[model samples]
Target: MSGGIHADTAPKPVGSYPHARRVGDLLLLSGIGPRIPGSDAIPGNRYDADGRLLHYDIVAQCHSVFANVRAVLEASGARWQDLVDVTVYLTDMAADFAAYNAVWQEYFPDPATAPCRTTLGITALPTPIAIELKCIAATGAGARR
Candidate 1:
């Protein structure tokens, strides 16, 4: 079954796109950020009077982003355990990867059941968020595969 999915519980996307799309036995999530729903607030953001980004909390962003992903997956009738792959982006990997990896350990404790992952260091995001997640979770027959 192939269809586009929208998660009302998830924060509205920054651009024109559905929350996720289901193709065959897979649910492919869009780039999910740490923006809080309804308010579209990014956690851990601190700015100066000039709106220049100052210090941001990678820990808060990590948890918030994971929550957003969970919202989308649950809305799309998928489970965190069903995730087969994930791609992550971080703006300051050199400075934040350790904290980020620590947070990752919290969500995904066991390597055996964890999804395959690839992470990349990027210059900046479209928004002020420090991290974003791209996820692929299994469904229907794919869950059995």
Candidate 2:
């Protein structure tokens, strides 16, 4: 059986999808952005009414993104330490990787316990956000085939 998890504290998905899904012992999270819940405001993004990019702050964006991820994890009965893998997408790698890495380290702390990660540079996202996260977590329940 499978179940979906929606976090009231996290931004509502832009598409028709839940924040996460549980299949057996794993919780698969949808791509999470840094947009504030309800307001739909994106941190670190500065755009005009015409929807043009103005400026971006990678650190601030990372903080909000991580927090949003945590909210979904908690809602799904998972924890940061339960995360097994993560996929990160960045709109501008050359300019943002260093700052993003620094902020990421603040959460993972120890390399040994950190989840495996793969980061890629992308051209754009659904919103004006600079970064997003897709995660998989262990649910601590027995696996079912």
Q: Which ranges of candidate 1 are over 4 A from the true structure?
A: none
In model 1, what lDDT does residue 118 have? 93
Candidate 1: residue 105 Cα off by (Å)? 0.8
Question: Against the true structure, what is each candidate's TM-score?
Answer: 0.95, 0.93
Flag regions of model 2 displaced more than 4 Å. Answer: 141-145
True-structure RMSD, every candidate:
1.3, 2.8
Q: lDDT per residue, candidate 2, 1-145, as tens digits? A: 5767899989999999999999887899999999987878888778889988899888989999999999999988888888989999999999999999999999989888898899999999988889999999986654221
Candidate 1, residue 110: Cα displacement in angstroms equals 0.4
**TM-score of the candidate numbered 1?**
0.95
Clash pairs (backbone) in predicted model 1: none
Model 2 has an lDDT value of 0.90
Compute the lDDT of residue 56 as modeled in candidate 1.
Answer: 92
